[model samples]
Target: MPQPGATSRILVTGGAGFIGSHFVRSLFSGAYPGLAGSRVTVLDKLTYAGNPANLDPVRDQPGFAFVEGDITDAGLVDSLLADHDAVVHFAAESHVDRSITGAADFVVTNVVGTQTLLDAAHRREIGPFVHVSTDEVYGSIAEGSWPETDPLAPNSPYSASKASSDLIALAYHRTHGLDVRVTRCSNNYGPYQFPEKVIPLFITNLLDGGKVPLYGDGLNIRDWLHVDDHCQGIALVLEKGRAGEVYNIGGGTEITNKELTDRLLSACGATWDSVDYVEDRKGHDRRYSVDWRKINAELGYEPRHDFESGLAETVAWYRDNRAWWEPLKQRAGLA
Candidate 1:
């Protein structure tokens, strides 16, 4: 473990993606109080969701390095692990819809890739290995939030892959005594999200004067966590979290998809008339909520951004940064 004031060299996998990019930028931007002096090496596959433009802000920053590679490559992971003090694993195929269409990519990337990283980290004797996961691993909830102890019942292929990865990571810790911590976070929404998620997709579609797709009756509820808040929680876990333990991170706001759509329409200056009710996705989870009391009570983690203000700020970012997302949307054929 790195002592206080000691320079920490962290290898962040999938650092060019949505949540990973935000976390890396924030780490180098003095957003996390004591981590300003830390060095980061970002390893990304530059997949459709991984955009190099997202790291332009930190590209010139000292002590920051970028590498293009796949996490499933054990040789690459082993070489990289030698130079870093800690590993933050964020590399995964996470789109539910994409996984539904074809699960091979998700299984290979999320399961096999995580296993490769874990094996390399264990071999190198890394001090701390933080595996970033999702709340969807618990499947769905009817009325209450799921605690860390809840049995995983993943509904979608994406969530199942994540759950598998989580188990493998924890197994390494228990069997090999590796210092590993897992964080399962709620739905993350903020700037630079790849316009495929619900928040960004709706925001970008509405910005283009196009209709937004709403699945089913739009009554499926989800807890929304801002990317900034989620990053903060992950930082806390990296600093003080225990080994072989699971922590849930949530934004404390619960709203149905319809209610969320209503908010988005209002933010984008659109109306319900612009919403296109699409066919319900297969095996769609009704509601997902995580009980993050463990992280809150132990690490003093709490969401700093409320939904309304965060949503407005996010909308404004997309509105002003048309040059950033326009190309992405066009490439994805969403424009």
Candidate 2:
């Protein structure tokens, strides 16, 4: 906890990525009231998914700073961890398809890098360490949603690495009494998301008059939480959550790929023909959903925007804010 009238330095790892960048933005925007006395330090490697432009808007803000570094560098992490009151770990190799092609990167970064951070936290930083995780760690579910205590049954290499990190984090908390709080959030969609992800990939394709690729008959269901809502859940855990507990954050709406593609068409003024169904990638999970009762009951949390409204808002952002995303598209050859 931060002392009153003192600016708590909040160190965020992988802070340039999708959800991590949003959390960085939310903190400076006063979205977390308890963090009024907080400053931010983002340590990121600026990988393909890590965009410095996302944080460019807040770079000049008095309380914000950034460094280009890898979390696997234990010496560097330890040196940096010595200065903060909290650690929000959002850095990971998150794409499942990419993981199938290259499991080694996932294991190295998601597993080894996280262990490096946890070791640093236990050795140097006694502040709250919020591990940002994904619901994929619970693997696939045929029907009912997964609670936090559910067994780890990750299917993809990406999810397997995340599960390994979660286990390491939990052990550090239980064995060493380090303050560790974990959050497993559902699929996230919003502005500044990399185009490789489903929503952005399809939306950018639609905007560019190209076909939107639909994987595996487009029936896989996912719970889409806006990045803002995810950032809110993370802040709550860091501020008010008890150590050694897991919380689930969700978007609260279940939509299959086909249904979501239809909605995206409506938003983008495109049609079903614009979607080109493609072969499913290896290890694509059938469905992912989170039961958010724990976060709501424990932290008084509620997502601010509903799916429909957020979808429209996100579409509009991509349309109007092309200046922000266009360069990224060009660099990625999506243009």
Candidate 3:
């Protein structure tokens, strides 16, 4: 793929968002061993969830550039792919609640946008196109973890769009012989995440001395993968994974919403009185777990962050980075 051992120029779509930004920052920081000499160009639309501030740390570094644009624009995507060595696509409208209210945006951005990128990458012969996806594509699981082969039964508009994109990415590999590697990862929690997500929403709400909302009985379970660990797993796939294969990246930790709420309450020194039980989200998946043995056995990939410590650090980050997140929350009416 990446010209065997040559230095690569990578195009990172949605690179200003939570997980994507972490991958770009890590690449510049030399965290990804095989990508020490990599040059990165970030293409992001800077939507409400995409913040330029997330890339501020790496902005001054050499071999790093940023472009503001939509992935659905074929002309722009084709022009951008002219120079890049590979693509790590993280672009999508990913909030489940928002997707439920209106699925059009998710359909256009996640499905159409992905098709646009794939078509361009295919034409340009871009190797090792890594499609960053979610475990929610597997839908609710009553028991046992889902392997990559499990049928995709997405329950929400958000997940369905992602599932569609995942298939499109893999299809390019099969039909056009494009180098597409797809990774479905567990729920991610870490810094720079938009406050709309559960962890950030709860942490930020409690920090403001406000009530935190817990849906239904708060028994829904999820595997929490830290952003850094997720980025590392993505790097391993981009570097060593085979084309047309799917990998499941997980945090190796499982917890229910109630347990997670308890941890958050303890972390912020807040009481259960601050917890407000909200109505359940529409078509909310009961549980999600992924079998990541393939990534481990093949690429030596493993999550480096333990859930407890990772959550602590994440809460501390939000506590310390108020100025960075406050404006975002206010703009999005989340404050």
TM-score for each model? 0.98, 0.97, 0.99
Total backbone collisions for each predicted model: 0, 0, 0
Which stretches in model 1 have alpha-carbon errors above 4 Å? 1-5
Error (Å) of candidate 1 at residue 72 is 0.7
Give the number of the best model, judged by TM-score. 3
Instruction: Please identify which of the two predictions, 2 or 3, would achieve the higher lDDT against the true structure.
Output: 3
Better of 1 and 2 by lDDT: 1
lDDT of 1: 0.93
Window of ten residues with lowest summed lDDT in model 3 = 1-10
For residues 174-211, write the lDDT of model 3, one tens digit per residue.
99999999999999999999999999999999999999
Query: What does candidate 2's lDDT look like per residue over 1-335, in tens digits?
Result: 44312467888999998889988888888778888858789999998889999998789999888999999998999999888778989999898888998899899999999899989888874568889899999998978899998999999899999999999999999998888999999999999999888898888788877888889888899999999998999888988888999999998989999999999898888988897778997888999988999999999989998999999988888888778777887887777
Deviating ranges (above 4 Å) for candidate 2: 1-6
Error of 1 at 53 (Å): 0.9
lDDT of 2 at 136: 95
Better of 2 and 3 by TM-score: 3
lDDT of 1 by residue, 13-88 (tens): 9999999999999998888876668889999999989999999999999999999999999999999999887988
